[model samples]
Target: MDARPLLPSNEPDVASSPLAVRGLTVSYGEKPALFSVDATFPPAAMSAIVGPNGAGKSTLLKAALGIVPRLSGTVTVFGEPLARARSRIAYVPQRASVDWDFPARVMDVVLMGLYGELGFLGRVKAQHRARATDALDRVGMADFADRQIGQLSGGQQQRVFLARALVQDAALTLLDEPFAGVDAATERAIVAVLKTLKADEKAVVAVHHDLSTVPDTFDHVLLVNVRRMAEGPVATAFTAEALQATYGGRLAVAQLDRVAPR
Candidate 1:
């Protein structure tokens, strides 16, 4: 897969970014997870959110999408508030956070992505099924459409969730650790689909854990450790200094050499 940056023809102003977070903060009880973090993910770009464990990387996404309660901050999608732009965004949560025993077939799970468009009393038509099937095929899960989600391997489950996000055809796609437990082939499939998304002028933002894959996978990176450490193009912002500041001593020296060798 070609991971080269595919810049958008007409870049929108900062205010019109696909996703823009301002003064975002989240807390669990008295513990602050994210603190006044501000970041912007541009259209047609693949961005990664990276940090050490418990560094509020996931919290930032949850807070931005209103999945978790925010103590203070505002989230805007395509220059509009979340409510107005909710349909334009698609989210794939952490695979570990999902319950595989939900008793839903792979097709049923993928169809759930259309519920926003289906609405109350809206029926699932043939075209909707076709769309779901196309999304499944893209992620190499079309054959497992009838299989129970719980019966899938860890990598297959991740691909299914990604297919779920694909059906939405959202402009801004947010994923939490899409490659966490997936096999190499599954990771390649996911990366290919993400690159396709970028080629189509869509924005992809994910909470990524593998620093080594950062340069090869994402063109933009936001380094977070309870706050916004650094953010911008991978060439400049994904430097050794920013990574060190983001991971501190928690990241092994050898790991740094692979990602941001000086």
Candidate 2:
């Protein structure tokens, strides 16, 4: 698979990045998970956050969205604080983090994405339903709208979560380990959806565990290990030295091919 380099033309202006993290630090109890991390995710491209387990990839995503408390620094979405632009951001948490057995229908789950715009307890109008339906259709899950979320397969469940983000019509999206438990077909489908998002100039930042797919799936890469090691176009920044530095020797030589400059 050819690595898709971050095109210079797609790069967003520094003064107005889609997502920017500056000196960000996150801690759990007294232990720090992320340390002074800084990175900018540009619009019109997919940015993959890659590192070994416990490297704070997921923490970075959560902290950026204010889901987890940040011990220091700040996150800006579309050049503004999260609070000022909350409605323009969408998030898809790790599939495992969600309780699939909660007994909600697929459509019901996707509708939750509108809560930001509609207010948490606002009534779901017909227009909202139509948007959710359109989102489901984009991910090829429209027919599963009536099925219980818990009954869907892992791939189907992932699609539903993506649909939730899509329906939000956000300018920036954060996804945590979306491809973790999905099949090849599902991965392909998700990649297609991501490309579409990029085409629409939406910024996508995802916690990606599969190193083999990163180069082929995303244009930018942020390598971290409790701190940001490297970030930029995958071709120029995803070097062997950087991978070794970020993964701390856990990354195998075989996985190197996926990130080799095209």
Query: What TM-score does prediction 2 earn?
Result: 0.92
lDDT of 2: 0.86
lDDT of each: 0.88, 0.86
Query: Which runs of model 1 end up more than 4 angstroms from their true locations?
Result: 1-12
Tell me the tens digit of each residue's lDDT in model 2 across 67-127: 8999899888888988898888889999889998898999999999988788867999999
Which candidate leads in lDDT?
1
- Positional deviation of residue 153's Cα in model 2 after best superposition, in angstroms: 0.7
Per-model C-alpha RMSD? 5.2, 4.3
Candidate 1 lDDT tens digits, 1-262: 1111322223336576988888998999999998888788878999999989999988888888889999898899989999999999999999989999999999999999999899867999999999999999999999999999999999999999999999999999999999998899999999999999999999999999999899999988888888888788888788777777777656677877888855
Query: Clash pairs of candidate 2?
Result: none
